[model samples]
Target: MPETTLPRPRRLLLLSVSAGAGHGRAADALHAAAVAEHGAEALHLDVMDYVPAAFRKLYTDFYLRLVEKFPSLWAQLYRITDETPPDAAMARLRRALERLNTRSLRQAIADFAPDAIVCTHFLPAEVLAREQLRVRLHCPVHVQVTDFDLHALWVVPGLAGYFAASDEVAARMRARGLDPSRIHVCGIPIMPAFAQTLDRATCAAEAGLDPQRPILLLMGGGAGVGALDDAARSLLRIEADFQLVALAGRNEDMLARLRTLAAEHPRRLFPQGFTRTIERLMRCADLAIGKPGGLTTSECLAMGLPLLVFAPIPGQEERNCDYLLENGAGLKAVDAVALEYRVRALLADAPRLQRLRDSAVRLGRPHAARDVLRQVFANG
Candidate 1:
C-alpha cells in the first residue's frame, strides 16, 4: 500500500498599520483565533514599523495630531479623500509614495512566504494590491474592514476577499465594483475574551466595582483622545445611582487627570490606564460611554453592553454611530449636556436599557475571529 502523508498547518501573515489602535487590535484578534482555534501558525506585523522614520511619523503622528487638534479639518479631508476616485492623479501619487516608503514590508512578506495574508488596515492592502499588479503574490491577501463604513481607500483591486463589519458595508463594496461573492459580512473581529461567558458580579468585584449599582464604562479610544475629562465630569455630576469606570488608554497625562477625578469622587469613579483586560471591564458594565471606535463598540456589543456614543469623530466614527443607532444597540449624544441627559434617561428607564442590550446581543459577533479564520482557510 502507498504511504499517506498529512498536510502541514497553514501559515498566516497578519498585517496592520498603527494609525490607530483598532486596526492592530483586529489583527491581534485574528492572530489569536488563527493559532488557538484554527491550529494555524500566525505572524502579526505593523506595516508602519517597516517604513522609514520620516514616513512613519508623517503617517501616524500627523493623523493623530490632525484628528485631535483639528478634527473639523480632519473630517473635511476624510470626506474629500473618500469622494476622490481611486484612479485620480492625487490618489495615484499617494499610493506611489506609500509603496516607495514600504519596501521593507515587501521584503518581510516575501521572507514569511505565508499561505494566507490578512490585513486589518487599508494601507498595507493598498501597497500589496499595487505590488500584485507588478508581480503576482504567492499567497492570497484578505482585508478585514475594521469600520462599519468602507472608505474609498479600502476598495483596492487585486484582493482575494474582504471581511465587512455589516451587510451595508458589503453592499457598498459591491457598488464599488468588487465581486459580490468576495465579500464576507463578519462583524469587526474582537479579542476572544469577549466571546467567553463572564460573570458580571465576579468582574465587578475584581475591578472594585459594585455589582448592585449600574456601572458605566467610559473610554477615549486607545490614544485617550476626546473630551473624556469633560464628559466624565458631566456624567459624574448626574444624580443617578451609577458608578463610572474610565479607561485612559496609553495616555499617562490623561490617566493622571482621571486619577485626580477618581480621588475627588472616591469609590464613585474608577480610573484605569491602558489595559488588556477591557473584556473584563465590559463584562461588568451596564453601559458604555465614549467614542464608538470599531473595536470598542464590537467589544461592548459582544458583552451585550449598550453604548452612549458621544462626539464620534466626523468620519468613520460618525458612520459607526449611525450604524449603532440604526441597529438599536446605542444612542448618540452631540455634546456634554446631551450625554448627561441621555445617561440619566437610560438609568431611569431600566426596560429601555435592557432593550438596548437585547439589540446589542443580536448584533454582536463574538465568534467573528474564528469565522474569519475558518472562511479564509476554507477558501485557501
Candidate 2:
C-alpha cells in the first residue's frame, strides 16, 4: 500500500473591525484557534487599521456615541436597516466605501493569498465581497455572525459560508435568502484559554482572593462603558459575604469611581483595569454581572458562569439578553434597584445559581474554533 501524505495546513486570513472589542476579539480567537487546532498559518488583521486614521476615528466615534449617548437612535437605525433589504442605492454606497477604505485591505489580502478568509465583522465581509466581484479570488470566504441576532448588513452575495452563533441566527440567515447548507451553527469562537480546565480554588487564590468565598466578576466589556459603578453600589447593599472582581477596562474614570466606592463600602472588592487574565477570573467566579455583549456572553457560557446582565444596548445586546433569559443561563436587571434584588436573590438561592450554571454549560461550545476550522477545510 502507498503511504498517504498528509495535506498541507491551510492559511487563514481572519479579518475583523475594531469598532468594538467583541468583533476584534472574535477574530483573534479564531486566529489562535486555527494555529492551535491545526498548526495553520493565520493572520489576524483589523480592517480598520488599514483604513485611514480619520475614517477609523469616524467609524469608532460614531459607534460609541450612537450606542452610548443615543441608544434610541441607534435602535431605530438598526430596526430600519434590518427591515429594509439592500437596494441599488445601498450597493452604490457600499461600493464607494469599499473603494475609499478597503484599498489597503485588498492589498493585504492579495499579499497574503490565504486559503480561507473568515470575517468576524461585517465591514470586512463587504470589502471581501466587492473584491471578489472585482477579481476572482478563489479562496473560500466565511462570515461569523458575532451576535445571536441576524441583521441584513451581514448578508453578502458572494460569501461561501456563514458561521452563526446560534440556531436562531442560522434560521434568520436562511429567512433572509441564504442557502441553508452554507450556514453552520458553530457558536461564537472564544479564546482557547477559556476551553482549558482550571482549578477554581487555585485561580481565586492566585488573584488574592479567598478560595472558600463565592466570587462575582463584574465587567462592561473592554471599553468599561456599562453601569459598573451603579452595579457595584447596588451589590454593596446586599449583605452577602462574596468577593467582587470588577474589571474596569480602559476607562480610568470608571476605575477611579469603582476604587472610591470600594474604599467607602469596605468590602472584599477587587478593582482592576483592562486585564488579559479574564479567563482565569472567569474560572474563579461563581457568576458574572455585566452587559451581555456577544463575545462576553460566549466567554461566560464557555466558563459555565451565570450572568446577571443589566441594560443591554438596544440591538444585539438586548437580543443576547433575551436569549440568555429565555434559556435560563442568565437574569436581567434594568436599574440599580433591580440589580440589587437580582444579585441578592440569585446569591441567596443556591439551587437557582446552579441551575443557571447548568444551562450555561449546556449552551457553551468550547470547541467552536476547531469546529469552524473543520468546516473551512472540510473539502480540502
Candidate 3:
C-alpha cells in the first residue's frame, strides 16, 4: 500500500496600481477568489504604494489630469505606447522609467518570492519582466488584461500566460505576435459576491428602495468623474415613475448636492457615498447607467444588469464601450439628451431590456476568478 501527499499550496502575488482604482480592485477580486476557491495564500499590493511617494503622486496626478482634461491627448499617447516596437525609443524610455522609478517595486517582488505572480496592470508586468531579465527570478507570471481591448503595452515576451476578457482580445494578442496557446479567454475577475444569487426584494428593501418601482442605478466610476448631476437630472426627466440609486463615490460635495436635489424633487433618489454594497445594489437594479470602465462594466455584466453607457473617456473607456455595443450587451448615450432618451426608451420597451439583460448574462463570466486561478496553476 502507498500513500501520496498533495503539493504545497502556491503563494500568489497579485500586483496592481491605484491609478484609477480599477486595477487595484481587479487584483483584490483575484486575491479573494484564489484564497477561497483554491486555498492559495495570496497577497495583493498596489505597486504605486511601493514606489517613491513623489513619483506616485506625479504619476497618478498626471494620469488623472490627462484623461479628464486632455482626452484626445490621452488617446494619442495610448496609441503611441501601444504601437511602440520592443526596440524602439518609446520602449527604451518605458524601460528607463521603470528602472529609475521602481526600485521599491523590484525590492517588493524579491522579498515576497511568490510561486506565481498575477499582474492586473501593465506597469508591474513590465517591471517584473525587467527584474527577471536581470536576476534569477523564475516564478511564473500571468497577466490579467483589465480591459476588453488588448493594448500592446500589456504584452511582454517572457510571461507564462495572458488572461483576456474576451476571445476578440485573445485574437488581438495573437495578431500582436503573442502566442495563441498562451492566451486565455477568461473575462475580468470580479468579486465572488457578484456571482451569488440574492433575493431582489430583500436587497431592495435593505437599500431602502421600493420593490414595485423600476430601479436605475447611476455611477461615475470611483473618482466620481463625469457629469453625474446632469445625468441624474436628465434621467429624472423621464415621465415614468422610477427610483434612482446614485453612487457618488468619494465625491462628498456631489453626494451632498444629490441629497439636496433629492429633497427638492418628488422622485425617490437614494444618494450613496462610496458604499461596499455595490453587488447588492446591482441586484436591485433594472438598468445600470454609467461610464463603461473595465471593472464597472464587468461588474454590471456579472450581475446580469444591462448597461446604458454614458460619456466615456476617449481611450480605454471608449474601447470598453465599443466592446459592449459590439456585443449587443449595452447601449451608448454620448450626452445628457441621449442618455435621457436611452433610459426612457429602454424602460418603455420590456423586450429590448430583456434582450440586453440576456446578452449580459451570456457574456458574463461569473466564475472568472476561479477560472483564472485554474488557468494559472494549470499553465504553471
Best by TM-score: 1
* RMSD, one per candidate, in order: 1.7, 2.5, 2.2
lDDT of 2 by residue, 304-354 (tens): 999888888999999999989999999998888898898888889999999
Score each candidate by Cα lDDT. Answer: 0.90, 0.87, 0.87
lDDT of 3 by residue, 1-380 (tens): 68898888889999998888889889999999989988988999988888778878877888999988998999999888877887998688867887788887777877887999999998888877877787657898889999989888888877889999999989999988887888889899999999999889999999888888999999977767776877787778788889998989999889888888889665567888898879999998999999888998899999999888887888788999998898889999978888888988988998999999999998998888889889898866
By TM-score, the better pick of 1 and 2 is 1
* Candidate 1 to truth, TM: 0.96
| Better TM-score candidate (2, 3) | 3
lDDT of 1 by residue, 23-137 (tens): 9999999999999988898999999999999999999999988887889999999999999998899999999899899999999999988999999999999988877777757
List the lowest-lDDT window of 10 residues for candidate 2.
Answer: 90-99
What local lDDT score does residue 170 receive in model 3, on the 0 to 100 scale? 92
User: In candidate 3, which residue pairs get closer than 3 Å at backbone N, Cα or C atoms, i.e. clash?
Assistant: none
